[model samples]
Target: MSTGVWIDQIGIDLDAGTQQVDEAIVVMHSAFVEYGHQGQASGAMVETADSLRAELSTGTRLGLARIGGQAVAMVKYRTADGGTLYFGRLAVSPEARGRGLASALVRALRGAARDMGLGGLSCSVRAAETRNIMIYEHLGMAIIGREDRRSLTGAVIPVVLMRDV
Candidate 1:
């Protein structure tokens, strides 16, 4: 049986295919670069193909959306505390951001998480990235708390944790 479905023409795969995972990595790296994010600067943000392979092997559920031979958006999810599903590493290609791909990915996760018998989806976004914060808020996520994340460069990253409202 297929474990994924197309939502808004986006491929939302929980049991990811090999090429889907590879394309996810490519999309993630490209999106991170476009956002001026340095993958090596943060241990939490290991944005490389090998890193993605390692994470995928460790039980991360990969979800991806592709168009015209390449991934355009993606996200990762795993079981977390209190029976919640923790999701992160959400990335959308620069050219695809405003086309509602990110929101579609989030909605897809809601369905996926519920289907897995999980409570809800949890995620964190940089506190300083207000644009992202607003987007999450617009998507029905409520800011729950703040966390200081450690990076490889000794930078204390402030992030806001959010959950489905």
Candidate 2:
């Protein structure tokens, strides 16, 4: 099926771990360049991916969203303290934006979390990612915390807002 027609049609699986990690890095690199070009910074992107891959490699769950049998979007979540789902590395290609793919993927994440007996979902994003922050907000995610001037890779990163689903 074409991508548009597959909007919000997501499937979850416990497999595909290694490939997902590989794909996450690829998509993240592209997204980093895109988001960074808009001023989010390249170092932040690399550090974020490295940190995520390290954790996701073990005890992490993945959700893949496909179009025409090609993987187009992905969501990764880790079991956190109190059994909360700590969501991460949600990336959709720039060409795939505005398709409601990200929202659909999050819904899939919540469903998977619920199946695992998790209470809710949570995630952190760059505070300056206003577009992403707004999208998450519109999807019913509420900001619960924020960090300012945090340094990573020897450079200061601003505003990491935590959200709950």
Candidate 3:
């Protein structure tokens, strides 16, 4: 298997199936399993492949990272009100954790935002997940504010809003 990671923006094909999409769904669900067990499952945990396909039909773009031609990490993003790229559901497979795959995906999305003339990158992280927040901080993002996001189970999750600085 190749040790190098490949990162890129994927254009969803609403009319046809794509391996990248399938791989992304697997990576997402697998990566979020911990959240599900913790009773704080994210909305992404409930998304079926078909639902994800529907979401992609709405112009949401995916950033994917692959190692050895196998998808290992993924992020979903869209342009928000302020011309900033609002990304979420960042997931890296357990086997790929600590390999810098998440960081690579973020960098790729940042480049994508720049290419689309977007102003900046933004995301919300569960406030309790300080490790994730720190990762974003290491990537040049900072906490701008906080908000409570209701999860699928109606649990109010405290999240911190972060933006590239």
Report lDDT per candidate.
0.75, 0.65, 0.78
Cα miss at 18, model 1 (Å)?
Answer: 4.5
Which predicted model would earn the best TM-score?
3
Residue pairs with clashing backbones, model 3: none
Q: What digit string (tens of lDDT, one per residue) describes model 3 on residues 1-165?
A: 122234443222212233457778998989988987887777777877777777888977666676666777777888999789999999988998988777877777777678778887999999999999999999999999999999876789999999999
Candidate 3: where is the Cα deviation over 4 Å? 1-19
Q: For model 1, what is the C-alpha lDDT against the true structure?
A: 0.75
Candidate 2 RMSD to the real structure: 4.6
Worst 10 residues of 1 by lDDT: 35-44
Order the candidate numbers by lDDT, best to worst. Answer: 3, 1, 2
lDDT of 2 by residue, 33-148 (tens): 66556655655366555565666667876656666565667667788886777777687867667778788877666666677788767888777778888888887788887875
Question: What TM-score quantifies how close candidate 2 is to the native fold?
Answer: 0.77
Best by lDDT: 3
Clashing residue pairs in candidate 2 are none
